[model samples]
Target: MTSHPTVGHVHLRVADLDRAIAFYRDILGFDVTQQSATAAFLGAGGYHHHIGLNTWDSLNASPPPAGHTGLYHSAFLYPDRASLGTVLCRVAAAGITLDGAADHGVSEAVYLRDPDGNGVELYRDKPQAEWPRNPDGKLAMINARLDVQAIMDEAP
Candidate 1:
């Protein structure tokens, strides 16, 4: 069996396909690789698609109520801190408000909601050697504050 398979794509049901496209394409800098009247495929660095947005059944539908069982968030990993910071700048320029930012020992992440209210996490992982571990060598992930301003300052 193949070990350590990577997640290749995430397909989302959005309320307004155009609005979702604006957020993912215009704001987040993904390329619109394909699109239909009610669907879109977005990718970065060009490999088919990383995210698919469709409104087949969710057209004009409302977001799920709080305290419901569903996707908590879909995380998009960046290659480095500078890349993540560039995204932060784009997000700010788009006037989208962030839910929060955090340092999770091995990663720095910023959280926000999409136009359809789905949670999105933008993050960059630290080097494997920098990961925190307990005395027994188990990973010790911590939820700590991230200095977002400092991160933004590193944007290219």
Candidate 2:
């Protein structure tokens, strides 16, 4: 059997190149390393790009209608719970509403929508040993409300 591929980068067709850059760069803290008239590349920690935004066909396009099968959500994993709390506070201060926040047994996640209505998940994974497992030794992920205050208390 062939090995599955790791995710390289996520490329999106955006309605406006500069606007998308601002959301990813100014808001999400991605660094813009490359740009053309139509394509832009963004990265964090200066290791090339983790995301690419292009306005090829979506130059003035609106978001896909609800119930579409594309892009359920893209998760951005934070380094720690404090970072997660910081992001949560930033999102709150920006007046962006969360779709949900959950403690998923293995991770704590906060869900929101990007400027283009794309779902985004910001999360931090719990240690492997702390994750719950079923009787069969498979992961037993449960979605319950996350204690936001407790997490923020961990923030420096």
Candidate 3:
């Protein structure tokens, strides 16, 4: 047997390419490394692009109806709580309304919608050495209230 595997970029069809680019680049700090009049690609850590945005198909299209089995959300993982705070602050400064925030036992996250109502999640993982686990050593993940104020305090 031969083995080679990898997960590549995630492409999204958004209603407005520029708006999506602004949300991902300006608010989320993803570098817009490539773009055309109708398409844009963004990334972090010098990779080609982690996200590709284009309006080839969904231009002016309404968001997917709720209760559907499509993408729930796409999460951008930050390296640390401080960096997550940076994103939270950016979201605040951008006047974006937050839909929800939570501590998922192993990670802290903030949720909000882009201009086209697509869900975006910004999160930070807790150190694995300190993650909560069961007696059998399995992760004990659950949705819990995240300390938004405390996370903000970590900023600057």
Candidate 4:
């Protein structure tokens, strides 16, 4: 296989395109790069699009029923802890409640649902030098409650 490839984009089927746009654009701060009556594309650092939203097939449709096999979640990686914390503050200000937050040894993540009930994860990875490893040089990851308040304190 070739070298590892980065995730390109995530497309979601939303019920209300407008509401979904509000979440990704206003709340999460992605730029609305393109939009149509039933579809939209959003980007962060000026790439074409990092996220795409569409109501073509799912317009007004209810979220997928629970207890079914579907996407676990889409993870958005921030550049640093402070940047991640800044978004956490935005999430709180918008009254979007998080489902959970955790420190996974090599990363810190916050989980929540989108307007259409699609799971989302906002996170930042620790430097590789700080990653936990066993004596044999294997990864040693842990799931622990994250200090959300402390993280928020670093918000810009």
Candidate 5:
């Protein structure tokens, strides 16, 4: 594997294809590249896909029970704080309640669940020079309350 390889995409099993599409497309603003009765591929900036939603084996299936080992969340990184805030506003307008919001020293993030109950995180990273570091130069990440209103103020 290449040392600099990046995560290409995330594929999720969803109970309803259309509902998932509405959330990812209408709410989060990803463009739908391709879709079928059982699956859909969505992307940003015209890449092939950053997210894949499917109902092949999971059609109408319920989300996994709590405490079971499974995916924690799939995070989407916005290009900047304004972009992140813009999407956060859309989520709020759509009546989606955020699970949490935090400043993690290097980034600000908002957490929520998709229509199928899959965890999702939307965030924007601060510049490398702004990341917190310990005296030894190691990262010193902290979870602190993020002023979501401040971010919204920066949105277009």
Candidate 6:
């Protein structure tokens, strides 16, 4: 049995395929690897597909209501601080309002909702050597304010 398995991708049921594609491709900078009338596959850096969007069961459907048990969010990891900041700038330029931003000890993250009201998190992990640890050597993650301005300043 393998103890290390990485998350391969996320498949989402969206209301509009084209609109969702615009958000993930245009705003978030993923390339449209493949698409159909009701589905699209997007990826970064030429990977097959990191995100799969489909209108199969949710065409023109409303987003899930609040206080329900469903997908909380989908997190996308950036390679570095500057890359993360660059994406944040793109997000802002697209007029997308962030839900929040935080420094989670081991990573810095910004949360926002997608075009279909699906929660999305964009983040970058700090080096393992920089992750916080308790005196007893246990992980000590913290949710603190992220200096978004400082991060954005690092963008190319």
Lowest summed lDDT over 10 consecutive residues: which window, candidate 1?
22-31
Per-residue lDDT of candidate 5, residues 56-152 (tens digit): 9999999999999999999999999999989988998999999999999999999999999999999999999999999999999999999988887
lDDT (CA) for every model shown? 0.94, 0.87, 0.88, 0.93, 0.95, 0.94
Evaluation by TM-score, superior candidate among 4 and 6: 6
- Model 5 RMSD in Å is 1.4
Q: Total clashes, candidate 5?
A: 0
| Candidate number achieving the greatest lDDT relative to the actual structure | 5
Candidate 2 per-residue lDDT over residues 10-114, each given as its tens digit: 888899899888877876668999999999999888769988999898998999999978998888888899988877777777788889889999999988988
Worst 10 residues of 4 by lDDT: 1-10
Residue 51 of model 1, lDDT score:
98
What is residue 113's positional error in candidate 2, in angstroms? 0.8
Superposing every Cα of model 1 onto the true structure, what RMSD results?
A: 1.1
User: In candidate 3, what residue range of length 10 has the lowest lDDT sum?
Assistant: 5-14
Candidate 3 stretches with Cα past 4 Å from truth are 1-6
TM-score for each predicted model, relative to the true structure: 0.96, 0.91, 0.92, 0.96, 0.96, 0.96
Name the regions of candidate 1 deviating beyond 4 angstroms: none
Separately for all candidates shown, the number of backbone clashes (residues 3 or more apart, or on different chains) is 0, 0, 0, 0, 0, 0
Q: Write the per-residue lDDT of candidate 3 for residues 36-130, one digit (tens) a residue.
A: 97789999999999999999999988898888887778888999888888888888999888999999889999998888777888899988987
**lDDT for 25 (candidate 6):** 89
Model 5 lDDT at residue 146? 96
Determine the backbone clash count of candidate 3. 0
lDDT of 4 by residue, 19-114 (tens): 999999887779999999999999999999999999989999999999998888999989998998888999999999999999999999999999
What TM value does model 1 have?
Answer: 0.96
Per-residue lDDT value at 155 in model 1: 93
Worst 10 residues of 6 by lDDT: 1-10
lDDT of 4 at 130: 95
